[model samples]
Target chain A: MPTLSIAELKKQANLIRQDIILMLERAGSGHPSGALGMADIFAVLYFQILNHTPHKPNSPLRDRLILSCGHYCPVLYATLARAGYFPLVELKTLRQINSRLQGHPHNLSLPGVENSSGPLGQGISQAVGMALAGKIDQAKHQIFCITSDAEHNEGQLWEAIMTANKYQLNNLINIVDCNNIQIDGKTTDIMPLLSLRKKYESFGWKVLEMNGHNYGNIIATIKQAKNYQKGPVVILAHTIPGKGVSFMENKYDWHGKAPNKEQAEKALQELRQAV
Target chain B: MPKENKNKSTRDGFGDALLALAKKDKNIVVVSADLAESTRVWKFAKKYPARFIEVGVAEQNMLGIAAGLALADKIPIATSFAVFSPGRNWDQLRISVCYSKANVKIIGSHTGLGAGEDGASHQALEDIAITRCLPNLVVLAPADYNEAQKALAVAIKHQGPIYLRLTRQNTPIFTSAKSIFKIGQANILQKGQDVTLIACGALVYDALQVAKKLATQNISVEVINCHTIKPLDKKTILASVKKTKKVVTLEDHQIHGGLGSAVAELLAENYPVPVKIMGVNDTFGESGTPEKLYKKYGLDQEHIIKNIKEII
Candidate 1:
């Protein structure tokens, strides 16, 4: 597939946000904030950045996209569907019995999911392993681990950070969804990770910062990460908890709960107008 | 019994097999979590420096990394102490390795109450129980050096996940070097009639000693090496129990969720028989010599013999 221009990517991202709202509304229970928040990056990744063929999801030559923040799988499902991995109708079956689109992604059940994640902080470690394997085989494919902010509290994530650095995983790129809101309260309130940039740099990573919602910024930062060969690079993509809808934006209340039917309609209306 | 027996740690077999696998297949990579030397995965690390991933002291990350390596079509042997890997990283094993069905061989070394003086903190008494319950996982508790080596080879060839429990102490090797190993198949070491001594891991040797002593009194004892713990070899276990009519399960693990529990559970349902479980009772172990700890925990040859005598 040809790379979608920034304007086209933005439109695609907005569509993904709309799909997220619709899917969550139908599912009756799911995390919405990160799903809605991380749409543009997903759009940029699946449409512009990744060397993936939706028809052949497990292609060895394809770049591996690991969703460490599995709660945001609605966005992944929506993006994977839009990219022709499966039917767009499957999005409606989110969290339903025997649906491939699980509340958390399962790599076995679904074609496009690189790793299964539910319990947090494991995705990055798995991604690091994939990166190391790629390096060992001299493969050209990159391994991108998309993680969230509150998940940094997981000690294993830091452990994986050190391993990635120790291996000098140049093909490994970590895109942290640095949206400040976590379930219960603000990330600072629940568990303060004051400066993730400093934490990454301290672990010997070549850290980069990006605006997660901006298509051009996400694309550019990712490109810069792809070019870095010194060691593993982490792009701390700062995102709003709820990006498109007005009432939900930056709200921690939207962190773990799905939008009701009325709320979904309103969010979709706002999204359609905004688009 | 073999005329020349070479007493060796089961971990030696683990290290040798890993090195052998890496030599034959470049896809076989060894991952260590700071316990490489103890687990003997260090041999492969030393041989193929590039193939070894040293993930320092983090069992959780080591498991996740191994899963990732499997995703890239590389067979990764992830190593750590049993108490830490299956003990602490069960969640990682469940989701990352088992659920993903990643071709990752997990070496849980220094298992059971046999790790000697390091105390209860270092020993793993619940690895079999913890690992057996997991879906898409192959749990193997090899009886000796040869069996452990054979189990590792078969586990590597299998497409999905396998967890092999190995011991740190130099155990008395009983099984032959030429014994054929297959997943879910039990080896009937010494056959008799009056009673059956079902065992696994280092305790398999203890069971043999118990069986030999029982033979002096003219009580025929059948010895079984139940190495495959998860898919408990129901055929071998049940068939032995049917003839013997009395059973004694032995292991260096706890009475619950180990070899004994599997045997008891199997017998209780299919064929009801008097089953005596000889293992560390539901309690933590303290620091001491292997002999003292074994005696204290009722996991020695004397204890197995007593339990079998009572049941018979």
Candidate 2:
């Protein structure tokens, strides 16, 4: 696959944002803020960063990506479809009964989805396991786990952090979508996870902070992460809860609630204009 | 009558079997949660250091790691106390292992009253209930040391998520090496027409003894060792209950969701025989010797005999 330029990647991210709005509107219920916020990161991963094949989703040499905060699966489904893992038209069937696109990401139902996740604080530990396996097998494929800032409230997330550090899993790259909004309320108000960079650094992770929506920064950060050979690297991508759409941006109400037809039309109009 | 030999802990059997399997299949990996000595995973750790993962008291991480390894086409056996694995890290086991349909084996040691002297917090009376209820998880509580070893082999051979409930105390080894061991298959130790004695885990030996003692009194008892609690052997149980007309279920777990519950549910749905469920009666177990605990918890041969006599 040829490398996608930063402008092209940003355009893809905008398209993914549009898909997120449309899918959430069609489903009548889904997380929109986190999905929209994670578009640029997913675009960078599926389009340029990840060493994966859309056709051979189970190829041994392909890099593994785990979605820890599975509530934000619209971003993943839209991105995976856009990357040709499946038909983009199937994106409309999100959260429908018997659809491969479950409310939470199901690995068995979809190809390319490495781990099924819905509950918080589980994806990182699984990534640690995969990275450990990679180390044992001497496999070249890296393991990437995408988690949320709010899920850091869970004790299990810290346990996985300690594990990844103890194992010195340099092949693992954890991307934290620091959207700062959870279902209940703001992350700091709900449960203080301030000083995340320092926290990860103290946990022996190579911490990298960047503007999550900036395609160039995301690409650079991922490249820098791939170079670190000391321990596991965590890219704390600071993201707005909703990026492209103005009304939903930085609003916690859109954290879980889906847009109606008018709201989705507005969001899509804004995204299309941005593109 | 089956002679009472030297007692052996089922966890030891699991350890030995794990080591044996790891020796043959390099793909077999053991993940421990700082209970290597208690869970008997130290043997495999000592043998194959590379294949053994010491997650250091993190049961949740241990299970998640096992799921990850399973995803990578490696057979990962995660070992910890029953309470910690199914009790504390249940969500991980449910979502990561079972929901994902990962080929991971969960060895939950120190289950039931066999976790002697550790008190209620340590004992896992609700393991079978929690694990068996999960979709795509095979729950097995072996009869004795010999059966536990065979169960480990079978769990290793089988794919998907499995929870092998093991005991801490040295219970009597009733099943021999030659005993037929199959997943979801029950063993009929002895057959009788008067009443049926269905049991699992360490209590199987006690059930056998209860049968022999009852036989002397002209009360012929049929004994079935139900090692595999989930995907239960309905055929053997139904067939045995058909002959006996009366049924008594026994286990080392809570009566609500253990072998007794499985048997009761099976019989109630299919045969509808008069059943007497024998197990820990929905109460916390305090610190005590395994023998004293079993007796006090109404899981001994005496209790089984008492229940049998009352039902008959």
Docking category of candidate 1: high
Clashing pairs in 1: none
Residue B134, candidate 1: C-alpha displacement in angstroms = 0.5
Provide TM-scores for the models. 0.98, 0.99
lDDT of 2 by residue, B247-305 (tens): 99988889897778888888878999799998899899999998999889888878888
Model 1 ranges off by over 4 Å: none
Candidate 1 residue A255 C-alpha distance from true site, Å: 0.9
Instruction: Identify the leading candidate in terms of DockQ.
Output: 1
Q: What is the DockQ for all candidates, taken in turn? A: 0.93, 0.87
Give me the overall lDDT of model 1. Answer: 0.90
Q: Which ten residues in a row have the lowest lDDT in candidate 1 chain B?
A: B1-10
